[model samples]
Target: MVTKTEETQLNRLENQVDNGGGGAWEYLCMVRKLKVRRSVKVLKHGLLILNDSKKRSSLGPEEWTLYEQVAVAAMDCQSLEVAKLGGMRFFVLKLMQYVICNLLQDCANALQKKFPESKRVGRLEAMLLEAKGSWGEAEKAYSSLLEDNPFDQVVHKRRVALAKAQGNLTGAIDLLNKYLETFMADHDAWRELAEIYISLQMYKQAAFCYEELILSQPTVPLYHLAYADVLYTLGGIENLLTAKKYYSSTIDLTGGKNTRALFGICLCTSAIAQLSKGRNKEDKDSPDLQSLATAALEKEYKQRASDKLSVFTSGFKSLKVSS
Candidate 1:
């Protein structure tokens, strides 16, 4: 049901669009704020405007790109009601959708036919293959493109992503490392490799990535946080000591607003203090860390968790009583 207030807001937004005042992004935002049924109509209208060939040339290249996205979202909504009851026909419909996606690949090829050596066309083809779940085909296409020009950053990134998508983490890591060997200054690739390493519990490898990242951009608080967290996880007195310093730096950088930094400082300080006492200090299995761990855990929770939980609970109770 469209509430009266929402209807009034929709009217104002639509008027803004019809007046040729709002841009594609603002219109897209308005569509998103609407119900899916309403959004479908809005998106359909957007495609209609985008497909207006006479006015199309007056639009920017980005408008053309946005048209493709609008078309996809519109089709998603338009197909839903027919498929909701669920049958073998739904599977058939999905296949039909895949066929439509393949048509985009055909269109890309048609564009490339005139400019046979166009990198953009080749990139589009590989991406379309990926989007349509033709992983092997996409991998081959990306590889062929890379073979043609080994320095194609876009193609290399797609190939690495394809490897990860195909559950070949090791292959992805190897490819990333090889890429980094040639392009060591590619911060984005370094960050991606570091995340993959962290997921695999390779804290030392992740730390190395953070070390590179910090060396490249020392003032980035996020890199410092990542480095501190990794060292903290791979606990040792020396690592914890270093972690605490980085954590303090993080707190300073963020003006003490980062809860993770706050937790890290508390936990590392307690651990270091307990270690300094030298009681069963050589034993990694000692229960001596337990008491401090408990206090550290409680202090961490008190810093943010309890406050947020109380607010949530109070809101819920108030809603219940009002209802």
Candidate 2:
């Protein structure tokens, strides 16, 4: 985990790079180390270094990596260009302000020519096919890679992504299920699977995924909040109570800074309150919990979003929790 201090420092360096202050290399290194995405900066600065023969030559073997990095960043921005080598022109496509497809093809071709046996280069080709909307070619390329190395995690992920890009949610889920069977410890895949399940209204499966996530990283408030949401959607007396507990856990884990969890508390309590009415027995949950959550929500709004305070209060009033 990058410390808050380190993140602040990175933000400062990133701003410096944006303003042409010349710390692009250091900023890129830190961003990569932290696994953060700053593609705009990466493309702008990486191309500066890659396109310069003098600076590019100084890095030796690492220059290849910078080429790949810039290529990937350019793909993210979807910028296009044409690469001319030995009088042969290759059209490069880009998107959203970044030089993309053709530039990526240029980089991939260069890498493959230099290291013909490299699996990474092959994967890059597959990615290029995906970028160009050649779904069949991309699928075949990914399949071939997997045939060579059944354990190629990257290829497996790309295949799943390809399925998603093709609007095959069912296929994505199937692929993810199989992927998880082998890479059971991949939290990101699990989270992604959970999200897909949620999107499909497969709440039971989503709940299971969230449960696995919570077991893997119990301290992550996001898992708790997500699990609470799924349980709340499941909606029964038992599920509601369980959802309330998870929501409370999320609130505790976030130190009461999670407004969603607070609102969840209010909603769960209100629902439980309604369900318990006329049962001829007092509910065990404290009525004050809802009021406390409401108060905290109001305070949060007052401190940071006073302009929206009326809307917030009115929403609670609609939920009949204003009292």
Candidate 3:
């Protein structure tokens, strides 16, 4: 039998849903309201549905949001059972609600309680300690984990990331080199190691990394561009000429739409022109070098201008329609 109070609660829920504001938190608030009024049966019935395997498919992002909200609420209310179940669900969600959402401590504590002594939990605890700036503790935890599982990929990646976060570029480089020994096919790792080398003014190492990337995926323009840039940085007549070839390849791969390639071509051509200008003024290649650079600059400028004009025209049409 629906009583007056139940009718009022139903009306409130209907109103909230109709207004498009019935999110996870709002539903949980409604649950709390019912509980405060001693509506245990209704609360338990709703909990049963949320816990049901049969109803899992119907839940979307909002439902997961509710799970997190309820988990925190359970922790606050000292309800271990709810917190345990919520933590398990969150682990299945791959621990997203913890670190990425920025409530690291709460989720970490909840997960630890649910699965104390779990390897994944230990990893997360180490990360959480690192996040909290307890570097000593974090390092100890990472060291212990590594000692236990030397080749654990997840732990290895996290250790490298932790080294980077601690401003230890050399350490990070060493760790990545060790990692690549076992996982040589990780293209992104090679690229990242190259970036670190570039930042550290280690052009030779950066060039080697880009060379590895080129060998692994010869057709990619990005690797060509990077190799060109690094060679340009480590400038000499031979390096400049090699840089020019790579830049030309980059331009070909991208159909001349790449500004970096255009500028690189211009720079290499001018430098080569100067180098060969030491030859007799009548040299064909030296004179043609200037022409090549001029043509590249002019073409790049015109392409960029055309692109900007198209963007402006589209924006103006969009405003006209909206008005």
Candidate 4:
């Protein structure tokens, strides 16, 4: 797990490489170590080093790893290109004309030819089959790899990705759910499932996922915000009040600087005010809390978006939040 501070440093070094400020080999090695994917940039710079025989030889044992990284990045870029092409007929024709894609294919093939028994090389071939839209072949290839090592998490993820790419979201969800049953602690898979549920507007299911996430990692503000949003969308007096509490939790977790959470507080308070109208004043939201959220939001807009302050103020005024 790359810390935020380390990722920031990698990004800065990446920019230096992008601008021809040198450090291409160093940048590639660092990002590979961190399992970061800056594919396009890596492909551009990596090919430069790969094509230079002298520089390539200088790495000795490390050159093969470079080949693997570049090969993976190339396939990744090809997949993006294939996705953009969208039409099968156009993709078939354009893929042949895609020089970098072919170059990477050769790179991967060379490695596989040299190390026929290498599982890593085998996975690359499987990924290439996937990128080329050979769905049946890719599935068989992945399944073969899994038969050899059923615990390969990377291969499992690629299977889910294959389902997603084919627009079989339900299949992807099913695969993910099964995967999670075995690997419940996989944070990324849980987050991905939550996002997919939200995308389908299955807010109730999404809320359940977020609840699980919060239980597993209570300090994560993102889960609180997402859970709150889902509850708010489910909307009722009870859900709204519950959403407001999570929204407040999000704000507190983020040191009260999460603008979205701040706005969430205001929106929840206003909605509660509308619902509680004609009720006793004591039954409504705390006026102090409402005013404090509004004041903080106003201050934020003034400091960060002075020009938008009037818009923010007018928008809130139109809401006519109860005192």
Candidate 5:
């Protein structure tokens, strides 16, 4: 029932929405509410084209030519709304792929000059490209962003993530360390750095980071649980006791339904038992060590036994058991 002019206007509106123009969200909501049916074939083919575009370099010239054919076909559909939606979707998909593949340098530079307000688009494009598999590209993007906006916490975080992803643990650690020096109260950064150190098997460094997190947010159950896990990993009775204390604190804070904290507590108790068992085996006549090992083993066994039936129950029953 729509006229040609109306269709053109609708198409233009859709394009505007796709490009993130003002009122896109309102228009999109209206379109969704309208429930206008679109050609499934057009939608499917557009998605296919977008998918093909993701592996752009993998496609031979002939394959690329075929993709162009599909894209054109998808764009030439009868429904103006469908065509507009499909085109916008295709652009975003391709853009994301280009960013992931580190092919966004040209696009970033072009967009920066042409659309300065969309600097995020350029930066995101470059970051995505770097994230896909090109640390070099990511580093360039971060360096450029840092030069332009030295106080960009987001860019700093991205650089740290990229560095860690690229197996540059030392670089990641150093950057995080510097960030923490300036943002001394950032528990999230400390936790992230601790996780990175744990991944790299740098237990001592991980422990230090965990200590920092605990200092900042001592009441956070996860922080205590994580610190305890790290301490347990480092393998010392003193540390094991410290880990148990943290795990207990976490359990108390979470009201004991935190299965992860419970698991850690169980593991720590078992560890203490194992350590005591080893010591007792070394000196069989040590009654004090034997008594401690037996107590730890019994406590671990009781906790596990209590947990067996609590696993399957849910809702009120689970709450009752947990309480």
Candidate 6:
């Protein structure tokens, strides 16, 4: 005897097929058979079929309705394969519903544990491995996915990030450059490339990339800060002056309360002071250097006074000193 819920589910499934087409019923039967046989490969293929069917424009309202019903049935089957299939379908359909989508994430999570060594579960296993900090394994999973689908940008980005996390700057930059070739205007990619170049001590190229990012997004303070760092690495006094201008602009844009505001001010002051001292040592009779030194000293004094006042008035605490 069918329970009321089971009978209701079956009636709804039947009505869905009768109202429009029987394609949904056929797909559901296929899903049941795949589950009964415990065939992972066939189950994966069946999920893909259902995904395609749901995406088809030819699928009418009734078909879509039945597709959702079938997804529910697959989810309720309790097999890891079925759960994974249903979760993948749900993820594809309602990616924006993040809170509820956690259910799908849970399904993927469980399937990953059950099929720990399965390469076929690429994306799910990649995420699980990433969660476990198995960056090398995650990279392998993403690499395998890319082998099958080279144009997948998400996989490419994940692999690049994983490479960087694993201290593979060369690999990260290579992937980032490839990503840029495919997506030229990706400012984040350009910025990341600049950072990797800086890490590799390629200051000239880093400066160029940072300059490009600044051109695209002139208002972002971090871009200006990174650009300043690159310039300081390449040129001395002139670069310091340029860096000062950018730092000032960043502070102004951030309404003067950015966490790095004091740090930027300090660096600019120190660089200017160093440049002035260097010039004085080179030409003791140079009035220009003396004047520059005097001006830098006054600026540093004023900044220090302001910083002390800020600390007292706003209870502003500096971050812990790092060695």
- TM-scores for all candidates: the values are 0.67, 0.89, 0.61, 0.89, 0.53, 0.46
**How do the residues 1-323 of candidate 4 rate in per-residue lDDT, one tens digit apiece?**
58899899898998898888999999998888898888888888999999999999999988889898888888777654444555786667476548756887888878988798999889988988888889999999999999999888999999999999999889989989988998898988988998888888888888888889999999999999989999989987788888989988998999998888888888888887788774635535557778888899889888999999888888988998632
Q: Tell me which of candidates 1 and 4 scores higher on lDDT.
A: 4
- As a whole number from 0 to 100, the lDDT of residue 88 in candidate 1 is 88
Quote the RMSD, in angstroms, for model 5: 15.6
RMSD (CA, Å), each prediction:
10.0, 5.1, 15.8, 3.4, 15.6, 16.5
Give every collision pair in model 3: none
- lDDT of candidates 1 onward, in order: 0.70, 0.85, 0.67, 0.86, 0.60, 0.58
Q: Any residue pairs clashing in model 6, and if so which?
A: none
Number of the candidate with higher TM-score, 1 or 5:
1
Backbone clash tally for model 6? 0
Query: Candidate 5 residues 1-323, lDDT tens each?
Result: 24467566656776675565654333433333443433233233333433555543444443423332333223223213322445778677665444423323433444456567754654665565553566788788778878888877878888887887678889999999998887787777988888888888998898888787778777777788888888888876778767777876777887765666665555555566567755634333233432343344345546776564334334213322121
Which stretches of model 6 miss by more than 4 angstroms? 1-106, 109-122, 129-140, 233-235, 258-270, 273-323
For candidate 3, what is the lDDT?
Answer: 0.67
**Superposing every Cα of model 4 onto the true structure, what RMSD results?**
3.4
Residue 183 error for model 1, in Å?
A: 1.6
Off by over 4 Å in 2: 1-6, 79-99, 278-283
Which consecutive 10 residues in model 5 have the weakest lDDT in total? 314-323
Off by over 4 Å in 1: 1-21, 25-49, 60-96, 99-103, 106-110, 278-323
Question: For model 6, what is the error of residue 94's alpha carbon versus the real structure, in angstroms, after optimal superposition?
Answer: 33
Indicate the TM-score of model 5. 0.53
How good is model 1 by TM-score? 0.67
lDDT of 6 by residue, 1-323 (tens): 23456556655654665465444545455435333332332233334444574443354544433333333333333222223456667664444333223443554654446566644445654755664567778888887888888877767888887787678889998989888888877887887898788778999889888888888888888888777767766767677667666766666776654435445444555556556764534333233433343344345446777555444333312322111
User: In model 5, where do residues sit more than 4 Å from their true spots?
Assistant: 1-114, 117-122, 131-134, 273-323
* Ranked by lDDT, top first: 4, 2, 1, 3, 5, 6
How far in Å is the alpha carbon of 172 misplaced in model 3? 1.5
C-alpha-based local distance difference test score of model 5: 0.60
Candidate 1 clashing pairs, residues 3+ apart or interchain: none
